[model samples]
Target: MQAFRHFKRVVTDWFLCGMFLATFLAWLFPRFGSSGGSMHAEYVINIGVFLVFFLHGINLSSEQIRHGLKNWRLHLMVQGFTFVVFPLLWLLGKSVLGTQIPALLMLGFLYLCALPSTISSSVALTGSAGGNVPAAILNASLSSVLGIFITPWLVSLVVGSGSDGIDLGATLLDLCALLLMPLVLGQLLRPWLGRFFARHKRYTNVMDKLVILLLVYAAFCNSMVSGMWQQQGSAVLLMALVGSGLLLALILWMTTRTARALKFSPADEIAAVFCASKKSLAAGAPMAALIFGAHPGLGLILLPIMIYHPLQLIVCSIMAEHYANRPAPQAADPALVSAR
Candidate 1:
C-alpha cells in the first residue's frame, strides 16, 4: 500500500511537470519542419478527443446529476461565469488589444473564452481542495453539453468570417462528433458499463490524460507545419501569454468573490471558482481546427489556451492545496454536512 501510494504521487507529479514542459516545448519549437506527419497527428487528436469525452461520460454518476439539479443555483452561477462572463471579458480584452493583436489571434482568444469548463482538472482540483467534487463534476460536464451550441454561436458573433476563415457549420459538426456523440453514447451505455468503469477509475484517468496530451502535441504540430509561428512573432505571443494569464487570474478572483457573496459554502465556492475560470484545451483544439480551417493563423490564435492551461492548473493546484489543508468550518447545516 505504501509503495502504491508513493508511485501514485510520483506519477501525479510527473504528469503535472510533463504538462508544463509540453507547453514550453510547444512554444519553443512551434514548428518541427516535418511534413506528412501533420495528418497523422490530426487523426490521432480526433480519436483522442472522442475517447476522452467517452471516458468523461463513464465517470459521471447519476447521483452527481441529481445533486446538480438540486443545487440549480450553483450550477447556473458556474455556467454563467463560464459561458457568459468570461467571453464578455475576452471581447473587452480584444478591444483593448486592438490591432496590436491579429484578428485571428483575437478570435482565438474569443473562441477559448467561449469553450466550456474542464472536467478532469476541475473535479480533481476541487477534490484536492476538499471542495464540492460532485458539483465540480456536474458543472463541468453540463458546461461541455452546453458548449455544443453556445460555443459555435458565440464564435459566430465574435469572430464572424474574417480572413482567418471561421467556419461555423463545420465546427458545429465537429463538436457534435467529437463531444456530443460520445457523451450521448456513454450515457446510453452507462447501465451496462458503469460498473466496469467504476472498477477501472484509475485507468480511465490515465486514458483521459494520455488523450489530452496527444491532442496537445497534434495541435502544436499542426501549427508548426502551417508555419504558424513565423507569422506571429515573439512579441505578440508574449503579450498573449501575459494577457491570458492576467485574464484567468482576474476571473478566478472575481468568481471566488461572487461565490462567497452569494453565501455558498467554501467547498462550493472552490468548485465554482475553479470550474468557472479555466478553459478546456482538449475541447478547444479540435474546435479550433474546424473553425479556423486551413488558416495557419490558428497557431497564433491558440496561443492563449496553450498558455492558460498550465497556468490555471498550477495556480489552482496551489489554491486546492490551501483549501485541503485548511481546518473545516462549523457546518452551516447538519444535513449539508452529512450529505457531503
Candidate 2:
C-alpha cells in the first residue's frame, strides 16, 4: 500500500513523466496516431479537444464569475500579467533568447506566455494553500473565457498571419466552433447538472488528463511523421527544458513581489500569484493544434507547455502546502474580497 501510494505521488508530482512515455509510445508506433498515417486518429483528436473545452465550461459557475468580478483588482492584475506583461517579457527578450533558442520553439513559448491562467489547477492550488478559493476560481475561469478571443489575437500579432500562416478569421471560426460554442452549451447545461458534476469532479479531471495525453500522443506522432524532430537536438531541448523552469520562476517572483507591493493579504497573495503565473496546458494543446497545425512543427511547439505544466504542478504543490500550514493572517478587507 505504501509503495502504491508513493507511485501515485510520484506520478502526480511529475505528471509530465507520462508525456515522455506518450512520446516514446508515439515514436514506437508513430504511424498509428499521425494525421496522415494509416489509422487516422485526427478525428479522435478533434473530438477530444471539443470534449475538453466543453467539460471546462460545465465546470465553471455563474456564481464563480460574480465572485471573480467582485475581486476586480486581483483579477485585473492577474489578467494584465497574463496578457500584457508576459507578452512584453517574451518580446523584449526575444532577440537574446532567439540566439539560444530556435525561433519556432520561442514562438511556442510566447504562445504559452500569452495563454490564460489554468482553471482547475489554479483553484485547486489556491484552496490547498488555504488561500482564496472563490477568487481563484473566478480569475482562472475569466482567464479562460477571455483567452478564447484574446489568445488568438495575441498569437496573430506575435506570429503574424503571413509568418505563422494564421488565417485569423478562419481560426476564430474554428475556435468558436470547437471551443466557444461547446463551452457556452456546457454552461447552459451546467445549471441543471452542476451539482452532479461537482460531486463527480474527479471524473472530469480524469477526462481532462486523458484528453491532454491524447493531444500529446497525437502531437508527438505528427512531429515524428513530419520529421521536424530532426530539427531539434537533445541539447536544444535540454535548454528549452531549463528555460521553461526559469520562465516560471521569473513570473512567480514577479507575482509575489507585485502582491507584496500591493499589500495583499496572504490569502489574496496566494490567489494572485498562482492565478497570474500559471499557463494552461489544457488550452495550449488544442490551441497549438489549431494555430500551428500538425505539420511543420506542432510537437516541437508543445515542448515548453508540456515541460511547464508538470513543473508548475510540482512547485506550486509545495508552495501550497507551505501556505496551508502557516497560520492565517487577519481577514483581508472584505472590500478586497480576495483582491486587495
Candidate 3:
C-alpha cells in the first residue's frame, strides 16, 4: 500500500502527467479545442503564450544574466552542442533513416533538435549535481532566447520555405508581436513588477503549466479532428519514443565526452552536460504553434519533445543523484604540494 501510494504521488508530481491527461481529454473531445471549436482555443493559447513569455521576462534578473556571462568557454561549449551539433545529428539521422521512419516523425525529430535547452530542468539538475549553477542559468536562458530566431530559420532552411505554409517573414513578425515584444515590455517594466512576480512565483509557475496544457490539448485536438492519428499507426509513436531515447543518449555521450576532453572542472562539466542535453517543451510547444499554425501534423511534430521531456527528466535525475553521491577528490600530499 505504501509503495503504491508513493508511486501515485510520484506520477502526479510530474507535470508530464497533466500533459498526458490533457492529450487524453483532447482525443476524447476533439471538437472542444479544435481550431474552429466552440471554445476558440487558438485565441486562448495565443494569449497564454504571450503571458508566459511576459512573465518570464519579469522573472529574469539582470544580475543573473551578467553573472552568467562570465564563463565564455563554458557558454560556447553548451551553445555549440545545442544549436550546431544537435541539428547536424538530426540531418545525419534523417539521411540514414528517412525512408524507414515516417516523414512527420522525422520532421518532429528535426524540430526537437532545433529547440533550446530547458531552463528549469537544466538549472535544477545542474544545481542538484553541484554544477556551475550560474553557467547553467546563463546557457539555458541564452539558448531559449536564441531559439526564438534560430529554430524557425533552421527549419525553414532545411525544409524549404518552412513546410505547411510557414512564411518566415510573417512568422517572425508574429513571434515578435506575441513573444519577443511582450518579453521586452515585461523587462522594461520589471523594476515595478519584478518584486511582485518574485513573491508570487507559484502563480507564474501555474500559468506556465496551464499554457502548456492548453497548447497540447489544442494541438492534439486539431490532429484528431483531422484524423491524423487514424492515418498514422501506433508504430509511429513507438518509433518517436525510440528515436527520442537514442537522440538523448547520443547527445549525453557527446556533451560529457567533449566536456571532459576540454578539461572542464567537475562543476562546469556537470553544467555543460545538463544544459546541452535538454530540450524545452515550454519553448517548443509555443514555437510550434507559431511555426506550424494549425497544421494537422502539429501533434505529430510534438511527439518527439513530449517523449523526450519525461525521458530526459528520468535520466538526468539519475545522473544528478550519482553526481551528488560521488566523493570529492582527495587532496595532494603536503610533500608533493611543496615540491610543486
Candidate 4:
C-alpha cells in the first residue's frame, strides 16, 4: 500500500513527463502505419477530460467555497488575471505572429488563454509552499466554472471567424454537456460522496492518471490521422515551443507583480499569482475538440500546453519550496502558522 502510494505520488507530480513520453512512443510506433488514429486520440482525450472534471467535482468542499467567498479580493485578482489579462496577451501575440502563424495555431493559443486556472496543482503547490491552500482551492474552482462561459465567448470573439464550420451555439451546448453538467452533478452529490472520495484518495489518483494518459494517446492519434505532424516543419515547431515558454514566463511574472502591487498578503499573493498564471491541458483538451472540430491537426497545436504544463510544475515546485522555507512574516495569521 505504501509503495503504491509513493508510485501514485510520483506519477501525479510528474504527469507532464508521462504525457510527453506517451505521445513520443505513440508517434514512434506509428500505429496502423502513418494513417494516424488522431480521431481515436480525440475521443479518448474528451472522455478523459470529462472524468478529470468529475473527480475534480468530487473533491470540492463547501467549506472551501465559503472561505473563498470571504477572500473576495484574492479571488478577483486571480480570476481577473486569468480571464482578462491573459486573453489580452494572446491578442497581442496574434498581432505579432500574424501570418507567420496558422489560424489553427492561433486559435489554440487563444484557447490556452481561455482555460480556467488549474485546481489540484495550484492548491498542491500552495500547500507545499505553506501558502493559503483554501484560497487556492476556491480561486481555482471558481476559475474553472467561470471559464465554461468566458472561454467560449472569448474564442468566438477572437478566433471564431478564422475557424471553418464552427457552430458557436452547438459548441456552447457541448461545453455544458462536457463540463458544467458533470460539475453540477458532482456538487449535488458531494454531501453523500465526500467521505468516500476522502477514503479512496489513492484510487482517485490512479483514475486521474489513467484518464490523462488515455487523453494524450487519443489526442496524438487524432493528430496522426489528420497528418498534423506532417503539416508543420521542425523549425516552426521549435519556434512554437520557445514562444509558449516565453508566454508562460511573462504571465507568471506579470501576475506576481500585480499581486504584490495590490497589497495582497503573502499567502494570498502566492495563491493568486500561481493560480492566475497557469493553464490546464486537462481542461483545455475537450474545449479544443469543440472549438477545432475535425481538424485533428489542431491537436498538434496543443503541443505547447503539453510542454508548458510540465515546465510550470517544475519551476513552481522550486518556487514553492523557496517560499515554504522562508522566515515567517510578522503579519502571518496564527491559524496559518498553526496549520503550517
Candidate 5:
C-alpha cells in the first residue's frame, strides 16, 4: 500500500500523464470519440463542461472577485501577454523564417497565439505552484470572457475568411451561452451554495479534469478519424513538437522576468506568470471546430494545441513543484501555503 501510494504520487505529480493517457485512449478507441461515430459524445461533453464552470462559480467567493478585480495592472499584463505578445512573436518567427515554416503550421500557431489563457488548468497550476489563487482565478476567468470578443476579431485579421469560414456571431453566442451563462448563474447562487463547495472543492477539481479529458480525447479522435496525421507529414509534425516546447520556454522565462521587473509580490508574480503563459485549449478547440469545421486542414490546426497542452502541463508541473517546495517567507501570501 505504501509503495502504491508513492507510485500514485509520482503519476499525479507528473500531471501531463493524464493528458497523454487521454490521447492514447482516444487513439486506441477512436470510433467512440469520433463525431461521425455512433455515439453523440459532444452533447454529453457540453453538459459536463457547463457543470464544471457552474461549480467553479459556486466556489468563487465574493472576496476573491473583489480582491482579483483590484489588481488591474496584473490583469492587463496577463491579457496582453496572452493576446498581443504571443501572436507577435509567432509573426516575427514566421517572417524571419518565411516559407520555411509550413503555412498550415503558421495558421495553427496564429490560432494558438490568439487564444485566451486557460480557465481550469491555469488556476490549477497556479494553486499547485503556491501562488495567489484568487488572482489566478480572476485573471483566467477574465481572459476567457475577453477572448469571446477578441479571439474571433484577431482570427479574422489573420485568416481573411473568418466570416465565410466561421460565424463570428455564432461563436460569441456559443461562448456566452456555454461558458459564461452557467458561470454567472453559479456566482449568483454562491451566497447560499458556496459553503458546500468550500468543503467539496476536491469534487470540483475532479469535474474540471473530467471535462478536459473528454474534450482532449474527442478533439484528437475527430482529427485522427479525419486522417489529420497523414496530411501533415512527420517532418512538419516533428517541427511543431520542437517549436512548441521552445515557444513555451521563451514565454515562461519572459513571464518571470516581467513579474520581477514590475516589482510584483512573489505570490502575484507566480499568479501572473502561470496565468499569462497558458493558452486556452478549452476555448480554442471548440472555436477551431466552429471556425475551421469546413476547412480542409482542420486537423493540422489542432495539432499545435494538442502538443502544447501536454508540453505546458509537464513544464508547469516542474515549476509548480519547485515553487511548492520553496522556503517559506515571513510575508508570503496565505493562499500560497494553502496549496501545500
Candidate 6:
C-alpha cells in the first residue's frame, strides 16, 4: 500500500499522465468516447464545461482583482506579452517554418498562442517564487476573461476557411452563452457559494481535470474513427513535443529580456514572466470545442496545447524554484515582500 501510494504520487505529479491515459483509452475503445458514442460523452462534456466555468466565477475574488489593479505597467506588460507578443511569435514561426510543420499542428500552435495565461498555475508559481502574487492573480484572471472575446476574433481573422467555415458571429454568440453566461451567474452568486467552493476546491479541480480528459478522449476517439493518427503518426507528435519545448524556451527568454529592459522590479519581473509565458489549457479546450467543433482535424489542432501544458508546468516549476532561492532584491514591492 505504501509503495502504491508513492507510485500514485509520482504519476499524479505530472497531470498529463492522466491525459495520455485518456488518449490511450480512446485509441483502444474509440466508440465509447466518440461524439455519438454509447456513453453519450457529448452531453457529459458540455455539462462539464459549463460547471468548470461556473466554478471559476465563484472562486475568483473581485476584491483581489481590485487590489491587484494598482500595477498598471506590470499588467500592461504581462497582457501585451500574452495577447500580442505570443501570437506574433507564432505567426512569424508559421511564415518562416510553416511548410515544415503539419498544417493542423500549425493551427494548434496558433490556438495555443492566443490562449490566456492559466489562472491557478500562474498565481501559484508567482507566489512560490516570491513574486507579485496579486498581480499574477489579476493578470491571469483578466487574460482568461479577455480571451473569451479576443481569442475567437484572432483565430477567425487568421484561420479563414480552415475551421469548418466557422461563422465568427455565431461562434461568439455560442461562447457568450456557454462560457460567459455561467461565469457571470456564478460571480453574481459568489457571496453565497464562494465559501462552499473554497472548502471543496479540490473537488472542483478534480472536476476540471475530468472534463479535460473527457474532451481529450472524445477528440481522439473522433480522430481515430477518421484515421487521423494513421496519417500523422508518431512523427508529428514528436515534432509537436519538441516544437512546444522550443517555443516555450524562446518565450521564456523573450519575457525575461523584455522585463529586464523595462526595468521592472524583481518581483514584478517574476510575475510578468510567469503570467505572460504561460497559456491556459482550461480555457483552450472548451473554446476549441466551440470554435472548431465541426472540423475533422480537431484532435490535431488540440495537440500543441495538450503537449504545451505539461511542458510549461514542468519548466516553470524549475524556474520558480530558482527564483525562490535568489537573494532578495534591494528594494522589493511591499506587497510581494509581505507575501514572502
C-alpha lDDT (0 to 100) for residue 284 of candidate 4? 74
Q: Flag regions of model 2 displaced more than 4 Å.
A: 1-15, 162-164, 329-340
lDDT digits (tens) for residues 1-340 of candidate 3: 5444534544666577898898999889999999999889889999999999999889877777788787898999999989999999999998899999988889999999999998888998999999998888889989988988899888887767734546998888888888888889888999999999999999899999889989999999999999999999889988999999999999999999999999999999999999999999999999999998998989999999999987888788878878888999998899999999
lDDT of 2 by residue, 1-340 (tens): 5444534665764346767788999889988888877756677778887887788778788886776577778878999999998888888778667787787788778888888889888988998888888889888888887887888889889678765568888888888888888899889999888788889888888788877888888888988887888767898689778989989899999999999999888989999999999999988888777876665577877888888887787778777777888875477688899675
Per-residue lDDT of 281-308 in model 5, one digit per residue for the tens?
7677656655555344655776787788
Clash count in backbone of candidate 1 = 0
How high a TM-score does candidate 5 get? 0.81
lDDT (C-alpha) at residue 36 in model 1: 41
For residues 1-340, what per-residue lDDT tens digits would candidate 6 score against the true structure? Answer: 5444534544586457888898899889988878777978768888999999999999999998898899999999989988899889999999999999988899899999988899999999999999998889899999988998889888987876444566788888888888898899999999999999999999999888888888888888888888888888688989899989999999999999999999998999999999999999888888898888745688898999998887787778878878999987477689998999
Score candidate 5 by lDDT.
0.78
Evaluation by lDDT, superior candidate among 2 and 6: 6
Clashing pairs in 1: none
Report how far residue 7 has shifted in candidate 3, in Å: 8.7
Task: Evaluate all candidate structures by whole-model CA lDDT and list the values in order.
Answer: 0.76, 0.83, 0.90, 0.75, 0.78, 0.87
Reference-based TM-score, model 3:
0.94
Better of 1 and 4 by TM-score: 4
- For TM-score, candidate 2 versus 4, the one ahead is 2
Candidate achieving higher lDDT, 4 or 5:
5
Ranking of predictions according to TM-score:
3, 6, 2, 4, 1, 5
- In model 4, the runs with Cα more than 4 Å from the true position are 1-14, 28-48, 161-165, 330-340
Candidate 1 residue-wise lDDT, 227-271, digit = tens: 666676778877878888888889988998899899998888888
Model 6 misplaced stretches (Cα beyond 4 Å)? 1-11, 161-164, 330-340
TM-score (all chains, Cα) for each model: 0.83, 0.90, 0.94, 0.85, 0.81, 0.92
Q: Write the per-residue lDDT of candidate 4 for residues 77-194, one digit (tens) a residue.
A: 8888889998899888888886788766666677777888888889899888887888998888888888888887887786454335467788888888888887788778889988
Report the poorest 10 consecutive residues by lDDT, candidate 6.
2-11
